[model samples]
Target: MSAPANDRLFRRWTSRLLLSAILLGVCHPLAAAERPNLVFILTDNHGAWTLGCYGNPDIRTPQIDRLAAEGIRFTRALSSNPVCSPTRATFLTGLLPSQHGVHSFLGGERPSAQMGPDAYCTIREFASLPKILKQAGYVCGLSGKWHLGANLTPQEGFTSWITMPHGATTEFYDAQVIENGAVRKEPKYLTDLWTEHGVRFIEENRDRPFFLYLAYNGPYALGRLLLNPARNRHAEYYADKELLSFPRDTMHPWQFHNKDFLNNPTSIRRVAAEISGVDDGVGEILQVLQRLGLDEKTLVVFAGDQGWMGGQNGLWGMGDHTRPIGAHELMMQIPLIFRHTGRIAAGQTSDLLVSNYDFLPTVLSHLGLSDQRPPQSPGRDFSPVLRGETTPWENVAFYEMENTRAIRTDGWKYVARHPEGPCEVYDMQADPQERFNQFGQPAVTDKQRELAAQLDAFFARYADPQYDLWKDGRSKAGRLGGAAGPAAAPPQRP
Candidate 1:
């Protein structure tokens, strides 16, 4: 055993170890990256059919349509609730309003603290999407609307936020904005300003994995059109504007109240214009990512907080579910698109029913992180579907508002109103418009009963006893108060 022979053997073993480490580094970079950059773009009051990719003839959403062209689009997507705060909360925590307890708009119905016990506060106990991602070593940033609560200083795991305060009045230019808790005046339009902040966040965090929640409050109420009392001022100011318009055939009853000046062609065009402004902002954000060469590596998602009635059932805004003007497909169906170059299938459409609650899980799965199961969350990760893998997602998607709850399967939808109201059942395959309510009809009575049973079981399984109006009296108290209710009360300072 010579000393030189022993030394040569040791050197060879060391060289092999070094080579193995380099190979592992090159092959599993995502392990070191450990977090994927997540950009979740959420729009307020933007309906599913407003984009060109969604088969709308008039809305020129070139930026969003482009993303769809390069990503997978879910044609039958929906929101947990058809409102802002509750829906956003559901998306973040993967819990329905009944569980999260932010069932209505913030400051529009109940005091923030009374909404639930501190342990059940939507933003408190629930692990938010940004919060979870941050724990996994991702920088978290939020831009645009922060309707969950005015105090958006990352209490639930965000690092930076540039947001509009609760119930901030919408203006095209010179709107007030809050940047990281400081009240600031921004000269640009609301949507554009949010886009600027989002782009800046991306630029600054391009070197690190990050999560950016860009929640836009455009094309929603209090916009340029709704800001005018007469509603005539909108058309008068933007007259002859070549705004994109959906096909008249696609326009529903809930879009306008009547054939008055409020529902005139010009007013409709103005609504379209406001949406165009949001679309332009979307383009700016996308362009910024491309310019920074982060487009391919980043996972970008575009979705609306919820669908708007517009005028489907002679309704202008979100209607009371108890006496719904329209609860048809148009009012609930929203667009969900995911774009990650070479990861998600391009130019594809998935009929797999998806809800906003699925967003956090799917994003987490795509980033190669282990899924976190929240207590009693009903959402399932759709990463398999997004990856073009066949998934047997036979579970029905559930939606609720006030005293009404609806359940939709692949072929049928059943809606039931509590406190004694006529239930409705529709064969979505045949009556996609939901013009006919076949509940109690001799032909579909059995099917309706079956669906009702399923809905009942779903409620029993997922509905929190604390928030369930059918079981608890608190829900009734909150709804009856309306704008002056406990649910609408502002949050008390901690």
Candidate 2:
């Protein structure tokens, strides 16, 4: 044999031995021994009540159920706000809409105008989660949906970005996806393609501590869910299983004129099919992590951005921005699940009053970086609660939207809205559906006064003179939906 050929053969054997050593904890967890990878799966407009783990027996979500069995399932995972842009801003910034200054949903006629430097506040000025995570030795990547603001331009900490610039595109085919400042309109299934890219990021970043934000656009609105060729995958499955049911009357005041969607049985099945697609994608992503041996060392959190109220409370479409503009139980409650091999116990459920703001501090706490927070951050670390440790956790949850504000305790919930007659108060223990309002009842004045005072006082701390709507009494008449552009569907402008 030639000398060069002999050298090549030896080098191949040498590399295999080195790889075997690395696999056997030489480079632990595919990175440093202590740092773990974080994968946050944030979905669009999915209700906590729909998941099989969350008590919905009809819907198909075995993947989400498995997370519940393997980790902690939070029953009251409140959203920062019910809407997309504002709640998303809370997730990225760990600040409220009042604190962050993105009080309403953006993206309409002028996405270019909506995404301008001064159009909405950017994360550049704030201490954001991704930026801080990146600073703490993690490679951050966002795969889908960046509605917070500045959709076209990549934010500071995301090293790798694949985003939808329009801020709202439910379909999967022939959609424009921007990758690292490059735009391409391609024909691809969105759910599959996003998981494909997410898996690719994990595969490539196994040698370092990585944070993958796999935000999916699904379960939002069935009319625009996704343009899949094989749409009957779960539609037929649901129709056959007798899974779709609308419990309310058809012509309620809260519903819109989507009669085709309302009247058709198959339409509800189509929405279920879309959610099933998300579950399938979740399973695939988990399978990849297990295959790469990263599952044990990676923390996988599955949560919905906001809850959707399909056929609940006399409503059709759901989301904070949907026509039913109220902070009902269905619109604000989101599913929050966490899974790590030994960090969080298996088959555990907690009733801790957690919100979106607490996500950053809790994740950072689990990673041993809890102190790395801005002074203005409103999040409190709930790592101890996740670990089943006995600690003083939050007793109540508070949140808001464009014109609605709410505060909920273990037994009661109080809501105040704008241009309104009487504020809403529900004995959640007795009226979980929020049907019976006892706000003005003389029988519960003490409870009402106490909760109202608590909610108002909490908002006061986060209130800035220039940014607060509650303080100025502007939350009601300040800005409602579709005034500038359509809130449900932001115009797809070039």
Highest-scoring model, lDDT? 2
- Local accuracy of candidate 1 as per-residue lDDT tens digits, 44-83: 8778887889887766678899999999999989887777
lDDT of 2 by residue, 1-494 (tens): 22344346435534553454356444455333357889999998788988899988788899989988999999989887766777777787677777766676665434343344544334445667676666556899888887765666667588878887656665666778877676788687687778888999999998788899999887665554423322635666776554544454554565553445553556566667778888988998899899999877899999988777767765655444345356777777899999998788899998888888888788877876565555567788888877889778767778877556688888999876543424778999988988888878888888888887887788778754445654443221126653222223321111
Off by over 4 Å in 1: 1-34, 110-121, 150-152, 221-224, 227-238, 241-262, 473-494
lDDT of each: 0.69, 0.71
| Model 2 Cα shift for residue 225 (angstroms) | 5.1
Q: Against the true structure, what is each candidate's TM-score?
A: 0.82, 0.84
